[model samples]
Target: MQTIVYDETNKINEQAVQWMEDLLNFAADKLNVAEHAEVSVSFVDNAKIKEINREYRDKDAVTDVISFAIEDDEEDLFKEFEGSGITIPRDLGDIFISYDKAVEQAEEYGHDINREIGFLLVHGFLHLNGYDHMTVEEEKIMFSLQEEILRDYGLKR
Candidate 1:
């Protein structure tokens, strides 16, 4: 999978960036996504994430991660391309992660920063793959899948 990661806040070091890439690749494999599947991940600070949450979700609060799924529409476009017998990669979506919140949460959750980052990435990746936690059952299912992927990736928490 093509995981384009950007550190917007300059807080993520090279090691963290490498971890994110590795986690993303593992997540793609767990989700059964093809190597051509494309996803963009951005690391931002709490202020940036809060602004995005307020603008898009009207939450006005800092969140660990946010995902925008563009695959459905892209799938339709891909079908049209298929008519022409031209294959195209899938643009899954964008994932925004708040490094500040991740640090805080990692401390709160009693896990390492890598585990926290992996959890956040997996959670966001599932959303890009059409998972949701709007209800208790949905939350359970989504959380279970997230944990499963993380555990398999050796990021148990």
Candidate 2:
């Protein structure tokens, strides 16, 4: 799978972007996404992320990461990736990350900004792959898989 990193704001550093790319590539490899599968990661400011969160999720808050899936219908989402008459490379989804939030959270959590960004990217990718943490059970599964992917990628806090 290919991950394209875009900096909507000039806040993110090159190292962070490169790390994001590596983390996403690692995630895609572990999750078994198509080699041609495309996921876009945009680094934005808190204002942009808050706007997106309000517009898409109906929550007027600034989140560290937000995902926009291609297919809201769970059943049809993976079908597009199966190459069932689909000609183009699958556009998995878009992941928006707030650089400001990443920095803040990293400092708050006592971890490096790289690890926070990696976590957000992996979390957003999982959401794109039909993972959610709304409930207790879902949280357990999603977080466990996330931690596993991060550990396997050698990105630990």
Candidate 3:
């Protein structure tokens, strides 16, 4: 698993970025993602994320994190490539995290910034893998899997 991280706010340090990479690789292994899968994670300020939320989700409020899954749209495209003997890295999708919101939520949830970021990353990764919390049962399953992943990754609240 290859996780490309872009800290648009320039507030996150190298250590945190590396930690996120390691966490994502661990999560990918646990989730049975292909070894050559690729994902991009961007850390931006609340303003940029709010703009994205408004544009993509039609929500005016600022959210903590958002995910854009490539497979959601091009599932059949990949299936065509599968049996063609072409080796291509699976582009999972993109994850945008609000750095400002992360700090706020970390304080609100009584956790450190790393923990909050890890939670957000795992949540976004799950979304990329077709996990959703739109219904009560879905929320339970998704949240439970999130907790399990976090616990296994040594990031617990």
The best candidate by TM-score is: 3
Give candidate 3 misplaced runs (Cα > 4 Å). Answer: 73-75
> Where does the lowest 10-residue lDDT sum fall in candidate 2?
74-83
**How good is model 3 by TM-score?**
0.95
Give each model a TM-score: 0.92, 0.88, 0.95
Per-prediction count of colliding residue pairs?
0, 0, 0
Candidate 2: RMSD to truth: 2.7
Between candidates 1 and 3, the TM-score winner: 3
Worst 10 residues of 1 by lDDT: 73-82
lDDT-wise, the better of 1 and 3 is 3
Model 1 misplacement above 4 A: 73-75
In model 2, the Cα lDDT at residue 19 comes to 72
Write the residue-wise lDDT of candidate 2 on 30-114 in tens digits.
8888887899999999999999999988999999999988857756655544756665667889999999999999999999888
Which candidate tops lDDT? 3
Rank by lDDT, highest first.
3, 1, 2
TM-score for predicted model 1 compared with the true structure? 0.92
Residue clash pairs of candidate 3: none
Query: Per-residue lDDT tens digits of candidate 3, residues 1-157?
Result: 9889998998988888889999999989888999999999999999999999999999999999999999976547467677788989989999999999999999999999999999999999999998999999999999999999999999989
